[model samples]
Target: MVNETPQVMTIAGTDSSGGAGMTADLNTFAAHGIYGANVVVSITAQNTQGVRQVQMITPDMVMAQLKAVADDLAIRAVKTGMLGDADTVHTVAKALQQFDFGPLILDPVMVAKGGAQLLSDAAVEAVRTALMPLATLITPNIPEAEVLTGMTIQTPDEIMAAADKLHAFGTQNILIKGGHGDAPVVMDYVRLTSGDHFWMKTTRFDTQRTHGTGDTISAAITAQLGLGLDLKSAIIAGKAYVDATIRDGILVGHGYGPLNHLAVVTAQNQPEVYDDI
Candidate 1:
């Protein structure tokens, strides 16, 4: 029998810019040879400069879209992006709860790279309390992690602590991204439910084309999981894929541009994937 290609789903918003959200998730899924299905929860009148306006889809519509996909696709893994509000968040969690979509990789998208609030303030708690517990892996950058744990993350040790708190939030895995800070190296902390944890570091590239980094990485992880990789392997591979994307930055719109997802990179071109254990 021939091996079947894995199918993945991205439940997120839309970026007209084609740099982030569903666009980037689908791009990353394609790059990994995984079929991608999407459920658009919001639409932003946005480009590289910034998000000018956001119109969230209704909860019923979002659920309907989800139902349409689940009714047909054999979605092996899933990732969640920008759920617009508390109600939408609840709706997504409720619907997703009714099915087994394999591993749940959650990207708690709060603010955009241009400093626009993609998620409402009230929904922060909703995401943490309502949906986060259902996650197999939660990918949160520095600010999002701080908001979730209500703790400051300056020291590397604090990053570990934040991962602990997020793990307590009920996810079996946690990837606390440190790319938001200005440091010589981008440090990412990963902790699994089995008490296994490690810090991965790569030389940070200073550039404006890092707009869709979070979506890309989380989608990569989900795709890998769909293809049968374990959580640790998926996380490591996700970081490597994101590092390549960021390193090969491309010029898109005026402001912070999008990553060159089509950049040609073999395993030889990527950096050392993990740091001291």
Candidate 2:
């Protein structure tokens, strides 16, 4: 007898409040019916209000966790989030290069929703130099995109320019998320390695429970990839999953609350897709 369930891994920090980071990633993976594995890089004492204290795991320990997971479970896809510092980033990147983890989804988590910096400035540079080249898909919000591309991203054209700059870093695909923008509709842009691009537009819900949105979406995509969906379809499905999770908000903490991962059980609002742009 053999197990055929899809298995996915999340390389990220832990949120004590269980609202974001590894917790959210596992929840999203479970919701998608995928087995979830994780390698903890840091720990944060945080809640919906803010991040209080952060303790980074040693690089050696991080490598041990990565090897332990890779040695046993047949991980089909992996996503990285909330890497604490430069050493940990380098360690994870090296381990990723050594292993055969199917698809690497880099979620370059920089600042927490509560104004806490999760990844150090030096680690950002490490990600650009090391992890970016290994990423199958890199998802960045406007601010992260600006930091990576060193350009102000205001208009759609600017987003395209930023994506081009990111693609030059060797990532096969890029998804510039528009959730941080002040628009009535959130337009997430996707640029594939084939030079095909598209925008996924969804109505911006006025809610404060979008804490783990980035992790959730990226985890959803990883799970889809583990289940053997094509990259484009997986991305579209991930967007839909996140849209439903945000639209159906859940009250958890005082400040930025967590998304309803179980919202997929209800109606899913599909994003309006615009391609060939």
Model 2 TM-score (2 dp): 0.97
lDDT of 2 at 252: 90
> Would you list the clashing residue pairs of candidate 1?
none
Candidate 1 differs from the real structure by a C-alpha RMSD in angstroms, to one decimal, of 1.8
Highest-scoring model, lDDT = 2
Estimated TM-score for each candidate:
0.95, 0.97
Cα lDDT, all candidates: 0.88, 0.92
lDDT string for model 1 (1-277, tens) is: 3326578999999999999999999999999888999999999899988999999899999999888888877889999998879999999899879987888999999999999998888799899888999999999999999999999889888988898899888878899888986788888888889878788878888888898999999998999999999898888888888888888777788888998777655673354545443
Model 1, residue 86: C-alpha shift (Å): 0.4
lDDT of 2 at 44: 90
Candidate 2: tens digits of C-alpha lDDT, residues 115-190: 8888888999999999999999999999999998899999899999999999998888999999995679899999
Runs off by more than 4 Å, candidate 2: 265-268
Largest TM-score belongs to which candidate?
Answer: 2
